[model samples]
Target chain A: MNGDAYWLGVASGFVVVGVVIEMVRRRYLRGRFALVWILLGVGAILLALFPRLLERAATALGVTVPLNLLLFLGSIAMLIMIMQLSAEAGRLRERTRVLAEEVALLRTLVGSADEPRARSIAAEDRDQDSPR
Target chain B: MGTRGRGKVLVVVPAYNEAEAIAGVVASVTRAVPTADILVVDDGSCDATSAVARAAGARVATLPFNLGVGGAMRTGFRHAKREGYSAVVQVDGDGQHDPAFIPQLLAALEHHDVAVGARFAGTGDYVVRGPRRWAMRGLASGMSALMTTRLDDATSGFRACGPRAISVYAQHYPAEYLGDTLETLVIARKSGLTVTQVPVAMRHRNTGRPSHGSARSSVELLRAGCVVMLGLVREWPVIADSSP
Candidate 1:
């Protein structure tokens, strides 16, 4: 039963690593972000391949259950990932604001002149039509 | 007259859905400072604000979408910098900020890197009341303590930036709501720019709804206060002194 669980964990780790690799290859994931996923995948594989390492670390850390220790560490890692993503989101927001501002300014430069010229032409036409 | 020897001054008016008042605002600025170049940054207004400003003899930089006031002003600053403007003056398109005070702001810039047009400096007819007034006073005092400068109106958008400020803001203006006033000051001070305020009168908006109506004024006050506090903790890059 232990052997089966160990093999299942190894398989899941490999699957996660494989998906991340595929995503990187397809340009769906950036390298900086892929580093986190790859590290998580490798850590999972190492822990699965050597169950004793997890048990020993859990015991040393005063965690009564190895599984609980694993869950706690995973939660911490996820929390860190959440923080990193939040920072990235803020940077993206700033970039988006800059892009939006640039687009607005560029649009005005490109299309704003035509409207005023049309208005002036209409004004000239009115002037010609007037009694004066 | 002090602005005579300086380079061209670009008046940057950021407008968002301010069609009714934009034309009059542009015309007023033109009447006040005939030589100063007026650039109305239309922040993706769904109204005829861009057309109206353009017709009023003001250059229009129409954003593709609504980027709020902060984004709009940044665009104007970038334009001013690129066009080699030596100074940039910000005026609200809502007509609340009188263009008659543009010269005063420009004159103040001769002695300081940034000149803020303060409405509460015992010169303006405008009066602040209610919870929003309390919040403004708190923020003003807080920022004054933080920067070691007596800032009468920290939230005032009627401001002028010299060449140094224009470049600094062009590169790194805050993109947050109400950032043009509060965060920009923090940034200017952080970069070692001298900031001062000039007394300027303000008029009430002639048309359209004010950006922060009474219903949302308190909420906006809270948000602005939070942003100012966050600025205190945020790390800022130390820019080398480049004032001329």
Candidate 2:
């Protein structure tokens, strides 16, 4: 109903999204992220009902719209994702180099197996024992 | 091309059913450099490969069974090392690689660790063919670029090895692997030994098409690719000199 209350609901939404993203990235706040999301969703509903908390929080925080808060939180989450992905890519590259070397070594083994060395002693005996 | 020089250089020819061309190949090498002793690794050929090579003045080391190209070459390299040759050049028995060019490779070996014959290097190529052949040559060019070393004929079995390479190659050559020849280069580099290729012309195979098998198991091509890539990752060559 009131602009203040509507903006308050938006602020709640921002804090919740930010916390959720942070928790997911860190992999530490599994239950807390869920709890926060629910609490913010409920707060959003309450703001719609009361229509006054928005005015209070907006005036308190000196912010204008509720949407900006949500955008800011998502941006932080994205930064975290990018950092993690880069690390993963680096690990995969190291693994690829390792596999390439292995393939090279195996190929070498197959090529050398044919080189003549020695025969079994029993075969030598067989040749010696044979009648001329 | 193992240039840790002292004794005479020995050239190893691994021939299978190459009876027809053995004499010519041997004659060329002997004529070019009379003192260079040649050994032929006759890989259980039913044909007269050994006799012809022997007739041409090459001592034959017969393998009771056919041990493929890598095996034949390794045996020859081993014999060279055991007999105490100053260096060894692995020449094919089929007459594809030139014996006349042996001196050129030897010349390169004076400064470089290895001398490789490039089939497409300059103005030659009477016989290396097919889409697969072109593809292999292209891959080698790219691999050389990647390794930061210019290797035009990275897959050539036509090579000259010195004492350093012989000592390492004699131990483990992956003789069963078709592409083990290329891997030896990678191994040499990894072991911190210098392996540089010299430009030499490659001619056509005098006899027999050494089967590509299937497009799937194109042994020669696959091993070529594998060796170059492995060079980057391996800590060093499988040189026994590294161990404590």
Candidate 3:
């Protein structure tokens, strides 16, 4: 990578790290999930600072170019993040189902408890109407 | 057994849009177990299931949306636990599960934490055919080997749960579709609770649509298989051994 490209990568990595920290501080991102973002940021910073390291790894991995190696690693990281997100989504879905069920049960119980009174009042009205 | 001989029993009926059958089912359960409290959990039925169930002299717990059988049952279990019921008998609201066998289930619960009403224990005409039957048999065999006990019908929802089982399930019940029975048994057994099966005959649904018809059985089987696999890989809490 060129000097300008390397510096741009380093800056972008720092920005990513800063954004993740801000999210964690604001409680927008959970600490457990933020760790992944932080680690990715740090890895990006390390790779940007050591372009030779990427070249050596690419050679070891039988990649034709260092850029291809970077892309492969990035894709793998993206895939892992997607999997983690999907797992979290599944958990949230289950929790939502439970909460929805609880709410429905409560509504039914309260609603039915009042239903008898309503029915009796309606019956009384019907009786009066029948007399008329 | 009468109410005096047993602790408080709550009969939980999880129904989904079974207006045509809910009333009769509720009436039958009430007639069979006069002392036991009956709760019909209407799972967001678009029909008049909640109203019909209420009219049939059973307490109705209406969900705002359909949460499937597992979700509905979890709500019922929570209610039972909150109300301090000593045992809970789960009967389907489609008029399928026989309320007459409720006493047998409760009796089984005296020696076990969970009592499941088996439909194919050489007593009932509840026949299982095609791929669904094979899936059920595979699940039963797998669970039997895992628990080191014989389970004839692992998919039967006509089961009774003691206080221990109720409390555990109320807190940690799986919300997977059609996987509740198998998952509950696994969880109960792993928690060191004794699980046994009682013979009970089941009739076909009298009204409304069957949730798992012949067309959807394959999809249900696939989903159930995935849920079981997920349950196996998930970490489960190990309660203290409470079996007698």
Top candidate when judged by TM-score against the true structure: 1
lDDT of 1 at B124: 61
Residue B25 C-alpha lDDT in model 3: 90
CAPRI verdict (incorrect, acceptable, medium, high) for model 2: incorrect
Lowest lDDT sum, 10 consecutive residues, model 3 chain B, at B1-10
Residue pairs with backbone atoms closer than 3 Å in model 1 (clashes): A104-B63, A104-B64
Write model 1 residue lDDT over A44-78, tens digit each, in one string: 89988888999999999999999999999999999
Q: How close is candidate 3 to the true structure, as a TM-score?
A: 0.77
- TM-scores, all models, native as reference: 0.84, 0.58, 0.77
DockQ of 1: 0.36
Query: Which lDDT tens digits does candidate 2 get at residues B1-244?
Result: 2333247798888787788988888988888778898877776566777667766877777665555676666676666666667678988877777677888888887866667766666747545456666666776777576545777767678888777777776655554354456667767666655666666766666778765633544565656566666655655545645221
Order the candidates by DockQ, highest first.
Answer: 1, 3, 2
Evaluate all candidate structures by whole-model CA lDDT and list the values in order: 0.82, 0.65, 0.80
- Measured against the true two-chain complex, the DockQ scores of the candidates, in the order shown, are 0.36, 0.01, 0.32
Model 3 C-alpha lDDT per residue in residues B112-190, reported as the tens digit of each score:
8899998878787877688768767777787778767778888889999998888788877776665677777767766
The candidate maximizing lDDT is 1
Q: Which segments of candidate 2 are over 4 A away from where they belong?
A: A1-132, B1-6, B127-130, B213-223, B227-244
**What is the per-residue lDDT of model 1 for residues B1-244, given as tens digits with 9 covering 90 to 100?**
1333257989999997788999899989999999999989887676788888888998888765666788888898888877778889999999999999898899988878899888888896787688767777877788788768788888889999998888788887776777778888888888778899898888988887556655566687788777777665676676635743
What C-alpha lDDT, on a 0 to 100 scale, does residue B132 get in candidate 1?
69
